[model samples]
Target: MSDKAPKPLNLLDYHRPKRLRLKDARIPPLNAESKRCLRNLTAYRPSRPKFPYPQTRSAAVLVALFVGRMGDLYVLLNRRSATLRTYAGDTSLPGGKWDPEDRTIEDTARREAFEEIGLPRDKLKVPLLCILEPFLAARNLIVTPVIVLILDNTLRFPFSLTHSPLFSPPLPRFPTEPELIEVPYHTTNEWTYPGPNDTTLTTRAHRFLTGREAGGIKPVFGLTAAILIHAASIAHARQPDFEVELAPPEGQSREERIAWAIYSSPVFHEAYEAEEIKVDWAKVAKTAGGKGGGRSTRR
Candidate 1:
């Protein structure tokens, strides 16, 4: 445990004055394509974790989408400052770890966006489209992707000079006539591990080359890339041009895999306990080990 004391929650930090409210948040009229995308996003239902998770280990990323001049959909992204200690110079969505003062996961996302990119915290200006299921990240952190639409693009911000903003169309777009939306380029690597009852579970990690002429932006890979793939697939209502990895026919589903990880991995189990949630010993026993279970570690 850390020697530092936990920060106290401040409800008023998230409140905005009534004088700042406006009848029109400067949101432009949505085109037909934008409307369809919005409808699809609004209807999406993301999966949840099978076991309880500690809020202290949670983080969020804002997948902010907007309409481009040609009515095509685009997402906002930034290259991290190279001076950062971890994942420096990487391309990522605007977000950070959960804060004690945040009232909810959505609040954590909104607060991080406001602090990172100067995005207004007002919901009317940038409305949320969806909150995706949690993804296990490095250091046993659970990252939730918050999807929101940037209605008022005219809002200016004093973004950090170290962070460079990059705007690109959502994935898997072809070079349509009279437009230069580049083709999506990506590659996947498969990973497998032994499971309960002599079974084997496999998953794929994806890497997307952000090659749209951004001078200093790094490629979107790992968690960031995977989240974008999911968001784009939902928004466009079509699968990616390339093959996407799925659980084996007889293996565990995505949620089940996460649950298995929490039960099997010592690091994750500690997180589960830190939340003061009781473990289902029966479920854990069912997935603990088997005759064919290998000793290889999972990344």
Candidate 2:
């Protein structure tokens, strides 16, 4: 009656109080699927028993998994900086020892990825794929490798000169050549050898052989190779199209040769150089010597 058309009955006015509450309410049960999934995934228990071994001796490894739309999968590996004291210039996965602040091994892996490669781990849709048994390397350190998935493509990573190149463009489009998917593994006992000057310090090398009988020398045998072998197997099982042919050892890249020279003492360096595989050390040095940044050297 106040000439405002009765103020257009407030939608809340005519409805019964009970009807208002029932508009969009539906109670969910305690054992819903969402709750079950969360419970199963969150339930993690470490099996390592307390021991007298120095805390400093323990380490952790992470296998960062990135899968493409066509189902092509690749593992993130990093070449250690020449300046690092341990495993300098060695090609290995992005991971390191755990810290007191880390809530779990997954946390350690995420933290190390961010520190070593400038990647934000939170951007990854990481799901705990599986856990490998702890293994000891010649360095006398215990390591655990946790596999996780990277589902987001929008995330960007920053690379430093010390760290090896990132798999730019996000690992070739899916349905990658079967040969590319195949990774070979060999016995650790056969590969582990003592370094030049130190009888106590030793290194293991993993030779990756492409079908063409051409390959690069990967100095990550022992635990690292074993981990890769296991990962390849897992990926193969999940993807029937993935196939790799085993071939004999081939050659080493110049970068790899240089890294071997720097990390391994003169004796090992000479031995590696004398091997059948030929490396262009001068070219490698030149490639690594450039000043231009933010671009990849890999073909």
Candidate 3:
């Protein structure tokens, strides 16, 4: 009314560019719940008589839990080189027996991971997921499996002489098959020589005592399987809607087709494949809230 032609309605009020701009913006702290859930999970302790079996020696294993942009989760596994002394060409977690320099079982897991897979501890945003009870399978040693969540997407690994060339490749996505597999413990009953013994020595050679089968449980049985089952339970409890369908072509007989599906599935491949299901990122962004868009505009 002050002779300014009604002071023209405010641009923000009429056009609302701020609101539209915010409509397309992504959610802040994209990994908030994941981080929190991992934290709470680490704090939990399983009941006493923690280990069901008796262990004669101490050993450790690590399960690398990685979450991708599309919210898909994966675990890292290494295939031992066929030329190795033991467990050659077998799939297993990246870990080994505790060293004298190690402080805790966690330290052993970290150190072993660094040595076997070349994943630097600094590059990972790993939170302790869980500590599984020790498992024994005809072996004289007790094995502990530790699970950790890897939050960073750009993580990398280098190949070592003892590992297979396949695992040397940069793994930005999950593996198509089960990450870890247990093989039977190779042993021999032949006696070893003991020089100048009054009584003949009958020492049985049990060289590969630790490399034992996981019984009848999808080839990844034993302590490693226990760790996975527990971690899956925890994740399901937090997000009931989260589902993990196997990357299709599960039983296909064709090698090429199976390999193709493995490398193309959203759960496996780093690059998008035609067969991969497309997620509506816009809807997700809006649900998370844009900068200035009306809260109820979606309706």
Candidate 4:
């Protein structure tokens, strides 16, 4: 394969000289099934997550996903600035500590994104999917992982969205016409593929970095890897993979194993035992009397 970068896949006038499909508009389109898989992940609550350490400070991170040009999905990741005091230069989901003025952890994620990187609120219009089971960081921080969706094409956010719980099986929905936008070509060199040419970063993430092939690729340890594994599993499982020999001691299948992985890790167990995990839905959503909402632990 050529080592050259792929030509920018701008959708403007893109399908004119080729085949046209209803989804061939600017920004990517997601069907009902994809949304269903995501809902299942967001609503997943582990019975026990390790408790957060009392001495730890609280922080949160954003796991943002967007559809790629070829209909594949890509999660946002940043190589943290090397100058920071800790976890500096590590690959991370965009987020930071909750501040007094922020309405919720979701707000903190978006606000930090704007403050850390330059994702202006105008350019990014992500809808809050839901928060994942919290994970504890090595720094003694209880961290909530917030999931958000990047809508295809539109620059502004839709005021409100409604959807059912993940319990119902997903029914297929067809693509509706989307408002189009002409994205001008502006190239930057910072973007790099996180995995090998043959496989996606999603694949390497689920198939954890537990082997000799660990060189060169930035390590995605513990919670970050777990979140990616969860999200990537949902994204790729639209057509399920064949069963693997690996089983979680109880002889459960792949789906069962995926669910089990969250709580079995050290973070969840420690957090649960320490009694540091949050249970109130409204509190976790940051809608209480203005303070004291938190979630966390990891393996």
Q: What is the TM-score of each candidate against the true structure?
A: 0.76, 0.48, 0.46, 0.46
Candidate 2 per-residue lDDT, tens place, 1-299, comes to: 22221111111111111211111322123233323322332232234321111223345677775544443455666667768887766567777775655555566667887788765665224445555545454454546666655545565666744745554222222244444544542222332333222322233344432232233324454456656654554444332233322221222322232233333334423332333223344433333332222312111
Assess each prediction's global lDDT (C-alpha) against the native: 0.66, 0.44, 0.42, 0.42
Number of backbone-clashing residue pairs for each candidate, in the order shown: 0, 0, 2, 14
Between candidates 1 and 4, name the one with more favorable TM-score: 1
Better of 1 and 2 by lDDT: 1
Poorly placed runs, candidate 3 (over 4 Å):
1-40, 49-56, 165-223, 237-299
| Candidate 2 TM-score versus the reference | 0.48
- Top candidate, metric TM-score: 1
For TM-score, candidate 1 versus 2, the one ahead is 1
lDDT of 3 by residue, 1-299 (tens): 23221121111121111221112333223365445444555555543331111111345777776655644455676666778786666556788875555546666677788788875564235555566554332233445666665655566666744744322211111122233345323223333322111223222222122222332112343334334544555644442222222122221211222222222233322222222323333332232222222211111
* Model 2: per-residue Cα lDDT at residue 126: 48
Alpha carbon RMSD to native, model 3 = 26.1
25-58: candidate 1 lDDT, tens digit per residue: 4545656766677778877766534345556667
lDDT against true structure, model 1: 0.66
User: Of the candidates shown, which would achieve the greatest lDDT relative to the real structure?
Assistant: 1
